[model samples]
Target: LIQTVKLRLFLLLLHWFHPYLLTTSSNSFPSFPLARERMKSQYVTNICLLILCLGAANNTPWPLLIFLASLLPLLHHTCRVPGGSAWRGVPAAPGPAGWPLLGCIPFMGPLAHRRLAELAASHGASRLMALTVGATRVVISSHPDTAREILCGSAFADRPPKEAARLLMFERAIGFSPSGEYWRHLRRVATGNLFCPRRIAAQEGLRQRVAGDMVRRVGYEMERKGSVELRGVLERGSLESMVGSLFGESSLGREREEELVGMVKEGYDLIGTFNWEDYFPMGGLLDFHGVGRRCKTLAEKVRSLVGEVIAERRRGGLHSHVGLGEDFLTALLTLPKEESLCDSDIVAVLWEMIFRGTDVVAILLEWIMARMALHPGVQAKAQQELSACLGGAQRAVRDSDIPKLPYLQAVVKEVLRLHPPGPLLSWARLAVRDVHVGKSLVPAGTTAMVNMWAITHDGSVWADPWAFRPERFLE
Candidate 1:
């Protein structure tokens, strides 16, 4: 009776202090699981106390002994058996030890990619190694061949569900969507209309105009202030090209362009920033990092802006074109009536193209410029090649000049080889079925990551892998 009274008092105390113990914001995600877990804990405690009372009332040790014995198997499984060992016939790849439920999240630092590469290298595994990050089982491919083996097939093409992909991107973005008819349709539409060779060639004038404007802007800034910032110019030019291709140059005013660029930058940073909610299912409820909240806000802003543009285009009956040629938005809008997409899907495609296309070009240009600044000899060689290709007539480099400028192209290739923008090529691919990736047995449901960084930096694969030697390609 005394023990029961004490238990009741404890429960009352817990209920009274619950609000004080767990503080949550009004806009926070639901925390019903928190209450559920607490209730479960209390119920277990009550059951244990009742069992003790029964034992004492009967004056028998047998009941208590039997109950303790019953728990042995459960305890043994939780302690002795690791999470991954449950899958029979699947070979366990070498990886770090993990605590129950938590997995290897505690060990992962800020530089997770670099840390993963280090772990993979240290294990001296054949080609692949597995690590449990939070609840997710991930396999990192340490070699190019292993990466190809895993990624080459459709079996590993499905993307794992990520909070950012859902909340920030609305799960409509082609990059995050699962492999299906819709994905295939999106890819087909993109490749056939937006990225075909003929369409790309037609955008040459648009690219030249953007580049020329950037050059003029840089000259004005330098002449006025004796200095110029490349980031603003590069980002603006790249943003214009992508936006013009999507909504056309006439569709966006200066204000809209700035707004789109700002939102795009925020979206990029938010997506790139890791959110714990993805790994920990219940982690979103707390959202201590505020990643989810920020993403939600950014997604709302982007959706609203993109929706307005689409609405305006529809209302105005604008046949928006790029460089006086057909545009991607026009193609999407002009799709057959039978092949109609909802407004949300169309916005997603447009947003994704704008987000991806702008960042890639701008970031690559920044990287190449940085490399040139660091290696003047290489820059001089590229400049000489450009002059030779242009015949020293003070003419801007053109699309036609790209093929003829071997040394210039070589430098770009070397940069790409050394510093691939997507170092983790095709990140977060999920295995749909059991597959063997270069002697490594990757079971279905395993999250596979092709560590391109590890592959590129492997000394065995490349001679003097650390050196930034662009001339290596020339040789």
Candidate 2:
């Protein structure tokens, strides 16, 4: 009995001092009851030693204690996988070295876009960039071929996560949702109703009306103030157009419009800020930095407004045609029951549609105007085209005339290429399975972001990528 006790204590000491013993050779240890019993005894011994160590080290500094605690799990992980194929090193692309635990979090400061741009320029667009943000490993591809491969392939169809989707869409709307049956249905309905050629043609009249109002508003401001704030005017005009189209009439007065605009702006600003919870996962519980709280408040406000609009539409009758030929809301409500449409679903879809439609149009208009202002030559060319097409008509540019104006179309395309509304088309992925892009193996649950901004700016893909000359598309 004394010999057995001694043997057990010796085994315990070995287990505590060198845990890698078992992992070194799977075949070394016999699969017998005696070996199993010895293992259990060793574990107990190790636990006792751990307790004793903690008691003895009670006077250790708090930071040291925390550091040791953090290292304990890592030590166990490395030891348990000794000589295991799982621990084999894989070839990875080069990236900046980061500190332990925090890993590149400090590098990605408030100006992530500017910082990333600088990194791309310095590192070269063909190189793969990796950054460990909290526990997540983010790999950035600056190659247009890689970006195109990821975006166009079926391997990357699932959206990232709820937190990311919420930030991008400003609501738990279906647009940024995971690629599922619900998302498919939502996309089908939206494409059929809002993005189809026929629907776009119908919406053309609305766009022309809004654009005319915008031009008039800009002229009035320029005449009164001698110069117009282009961004502000475009923002309001775009918001009005979206609200009018979605509701078939403007429910938002000046105050409401301003409020909605502010909310949308806040949404955009919040999305750009790095939320601790987004990277740290459990960090959300503490509501660290109060970002989660702010997001919840904004979401609630938007939801309430959307709920009100949906209620009004339902009460007014599903197919109410009070001019404007029954807007999007009317079409949604009028869909057959067999189509599985619900009031909440309609509100969600409309919420996503309004924000996306308004924001993209506003940004695109601003970019186009800025580009035109920067290049007087391009501006003159556009003005000449406008004159030739409309004969100096003081009205909005019509959609019917867009096809006839090749230069204008080229300008739009160039702007889209240079400054896509979404720099990264929200991350997408296919269901858990191995996917290959060239030699790289994209494992299951891998998040894929099509870095459209990086792709468009790649020197390899475009000659003199920094130049904003729209003539590149003229051919």
Candidate 3:
């Protein structure tokens, strides 16, 4: 009778402790298959549970002890697991180690450009240096070769994930669209109509004519007053020239031109302002933040302006033809109303062309004038070239004359190298598939960017990278 009582007590203990043992074993196993085989026999778990309980009864504290023993492996594994591996198991480029969750947010202050340069200098070349500004990971690649590979390679051709695309494209702009058939088609159309050799040559005449007008306007201002507001004058003249050339008529009055210029400036200003929501997806919900509100407002204003232009063109009943100099609006409106080329398509393309073209030209002109003012030697050389080419026959220089003037061309190239309008060259592709870049594995969905600024300044590629030497072109 005493033996039967002991056996029943042992069975009760097994029943109580069997589940805990099984649970512990499953948790401890590295893989599912190992856990399954161990669990296949209930009798084995029962025997182990009985032995454990007997040990507990002997004042060994086996239950509590066993629980802790089961947990240690998991704890150790959790603590020892390394963070995400850098490209090809290469140690992440040495940058300031960031705080947990926040990650490098505190370091990026007002001047991102200076801060980035400083970081790159501190971190050795080809090392992975990363900063999480808000939620976006700003990975710095100090290698010009890497930058070139990413930009030229077909694998990385998509835009970075950002709010700018949605706002700028209105779900249709080609600049922000994914690189695919649609983008290819849009690019072909734009190149054929606007950027083709013939079209560009034709536009050169207009550009030269405008440049002449600009010089005259500056001279007038100089005559009126030794120092005039160059910014305002240049801004107005550039926009008017672009609009006039596009429409084949100067429909934009002073008030309208100023309004458009203000809108465009605001749009660009908004782009420069850091928006935390863009990098951190969840943060975007805070529309109260000025960036989100400003983007929406600017987008609406630009769209309305574009819509009005489209409406005017439609009302005029213009027909599209190749090589006819029909103007951008007329040429777009005249495209056969096919599924591929619709009115909305025309509007989006035209809007992008005007905004991008006008902004680039205006910025380039500003840089050229600023540089000329700063470097008297360069300005003198350029003036000499201009005089030699034009023979002082006219105050204005022609586009035809630009090719002949090597110094002028060199000046433009130098300005572009020194102050590239888009320093980063826009966000490039997210790797859609694994690509081996050197020893590093560019994982799928990794954001890529071409650091044009860095490329232009690479010491190996350019002599005296920092100096504003237009004579580099002569070499």
Supply candidate 3's per-residue lDDT for 157: 70
Q: What is the lDDT of residue 74 in candidate 3?
A: 31
lDDT (10s digit) by residue, model 2, range 1-475: 9558545654554555554322323355643322332253344345545744583457545345334533543444342311121212533334433333444466556544445545545444344454455555455566766666666777677665546347445443675666767788877777766667776666776777777888889899989999998888888888888877777756556776787888778877776667767666686775655666787788778778777877876676764453335677776776667766776677667767766677778889999988998999998998888889998787667777887788888888888888876775344344245566545555555555555677687787889877887789885
Displacement of the residue 51 alpha carbon in candidate 2, Å: 32
Model 3 has an lDDT value of 0.62
For 4-38, candidate 1 gives per-residue lDDT tens digits of 96457546644643432324343644333223322
Q: Comparing 1 and 2 by lDDT, which wins?
A: 1
Clashing pairs in 3: 93-128, 158-429
Better of 2 and 3 by TM-score: 2
Off by over 4 Å in 2: 1-91, 109-114, 117-127, 162-164, 167-172, 251-255, 322-324, 392-395, 425-432
Candidate scoring better on lDDT of 2 and 3? 2
TM-score (all chains, Cα) for each model:
0.79, 0.76, 0.75
lDDT of each: 0.72, 0.63, 0.62
Residue-level lDDT for 431 in candidate 1: 95
- Candidate 3 lDDT score at position 451: 53
Report residue 308 deviation for candidate 3 (angstroms): 1.8
